[model samples]
Target: MGKLASECETERARTLTKEGISMDSEKVIKRDNEYVLHTYNRNPIALEKGHGLYAEGPEGQKYLDFTSGIGVNSLGYCDLTWAEAVSEQAHKLQHTSNLYYTAPCGKLAKKLCKRTGMNKVFFGNSGAEANEGAIKAARKYSFDHYGKGRDVVITLVNSFHGRTIATLTATGQEVFHNYFGPFNEGFVYTTAGDIEGLRELVDRHTCAIMLELIQGEGGVMALDPEYVQAVRALCDEKDLVLIVDEVQTGVGRTGTFLCCEHYNLKPDIVTLAKGLGGGLPIGAVLLNEKTAEGMGPGSHGSTFGGNPVVCAGANVVVDRMDQSFLANVSERAVQLRAGLAKLPMVKNLSGIGLMVGIEFFGGIQAADVLAACREKGLLVLTAKSRLRLLPPLTLTAHDVEKALGILNEVLTEMEQKAPKEQA
Candidate 1:
């Protein structure tokens, strides 16, 4: 016997809560807490729907989003073109094995290579996988040319690569080194801008140097341009591969196709993920002529690397990152930084384009500011001890003004509520 629609609704409600309470934000949170692993310190609100630069909680509390899902939503929430492309591709050709060819994947690759001047591309599902593939490529390049003993990759301190064992091992922070035992070796760490230290670390065993132009996880600091140039020159001098991990700073997030463009630098390999697919999961390793043949057939691959729908969305995103669009992004970044600079408690600001980090005075807490801003219809993120803002590249002066207003209000409230010694 078939149940009535009303009965089905009642059953769902009962499943949500033993007391037959209807699903709400609190109920959803409780259910997730009970079922899901406690990996993230989740926000209180349960996201329900979003459009443009705004989102709503289960209870319909609107929020002006600055996080952009940590810089993945390049075109903002459910951009019409991006969504349509993804949907059209999903309906037409959802997926196929890497053994077969797909138009969307090929098209996206062409666009990436054309824009970045890279010779080849290898797709992956996330930043970690892309970096993992890059590590493999760097080592293989050295082994193919030199030998096995030259496998060490020098990475900068405070640089974040990814979560995989190899990438995590490559990450220079000691905090991420816990729990994961016996990490892959051959990775060396040096301080950012420390050319002398970097020189000391490199040897016949060193195969590559990997770094993030702007350390997003490490307080959003931009590496000095001169230092980055020095690193590039060193790579050229030492015949070591240079791999720029642009997972967070790529795809127009930093007002450029790649952050390396800011320094007029090029690398043997570059890894991208966060903003490349707009809202979908996609990562790519761009290989230059020096290391184009690093990975041959069957050397490395991913089943879902070049998914049709994800690549479809990424194509639109790439098309939108044209010079004019990126120029607008740079303009908005200036406006955003100018607005933040006017705020009373913002002690210092760092980052380029839309990627911004805010350091505060009077002992302000990033977590407290995040909560207060959420309560006031704004959403932000924290990096280390400071606040991080990765607003959509489509952000306008008007949106920046509204976001700044909310942050100013939150900082004012916190300052007023702070203890005398802290203030």
Candidate 2:
């Protein structure tokens, strides 16, 4: 039952065994509940260690990691090179406030700019901060040029930007709007793939348009390619800033170094986080020449942003995402999608590259599927009405096959039990 639910989470705290064993998982979860904020409904297992695409519980039970820490561990769990880079940087000089320059920051900035054709970079601590910086830059650019009338940014309905008040406001979903009062204003929403509705939203007051090439948390939905091209054209015609929130889809998660690469879009600004730091905390806003200078000194800053250790890990990640690596990601995506399409309960698949969504048509809940998978030594994620898979980029061939096999077994079990469940 540990697989089906938080089977082991409710037990009292544990102590050392007769042979002098260390503290087990239950104690940690118990302590966490007592001290930590109740924001997350965390899973039961106390994952103590990880390597490659596998994580081990407190009792040393290994599980295949398909969620990849929600698309943040691009190199999977504790890759050797990434760990070495981070460790070396930490020893060298871990923290130097952004007031002064550092080698790692400049190196990462150049790599990102050269790879993505973005001219400038702003560092932040998370996706929300990155998006906030972008929003500010867009509005500032508008104010600097046109002045006083244009400040609105149009994002797609159901699209997710971040968790901050400004980003929550920028997000087009109404559900996230509750309880967060008086969110930073100047954001509007429109239906995905609807050009006419977009036109109606864009008046003289519009400053920019934000897009998530593949809307990750909003049920893994992707915008139509033709529609994206149309949006790019419209932005060009109107001189509107185009911002792509690639927090989940960037850093080679979508089979390309950046999701915009798949669309051949050189957006005015692109925000990145998640996989960029492998497993460390980091975020960046990549800006093009047209908008690079949009933000000047004294405008924005973060204390721990661009930490040397994080940038070191990020540099390693970026270096490994060359042409050959991204090509392999595309190939793996094809393999996984093909396998998923043949599953008994999967009605369809949405998203691209390693970022995928399995839409079930047999009335099976995505949350149930996720729990069942976890119980069966496989970890997965859920987004809205679908099961989202954000496997690590460095996932091996054996792990992929193992994940698909477990998924098939789960689908079969669900289908077999569906009739009884209804009865």
Per-model lDDT: 0.91, 0.89
Candidate 2 similarity to native, TM-score: 0.94
Which regions in candidate 2 have their CA more than 4 angstroms from the true location? 1-21, 420-423
Provide the clashing-pair count of each candidate structure: 0, 1
Error of 2 at 219 (Å): 0.6
- Most accurate candidate by lDDT: 1
Candidate 1: tens digits of C-alpha lDDT, residues 1-423: 013434765787678688666657988899999999998999989987788899988677899999999999999998888887887788799989799999999999899999999999999999999999999999999999997799999998898998888999999999999998799879989999999999999889999999899999999999999999999999999999999999999999888899989989989999999899999999999999778775789899999999999999999999998889999999999889998998867889999889999998868988889999999999999999889999888888899999999998998887788776665
All candidates' TM-scores?
0.94, 0.94
lDDT of 1 at 95: 88
Candidate 2 has an lDDT of 0.89
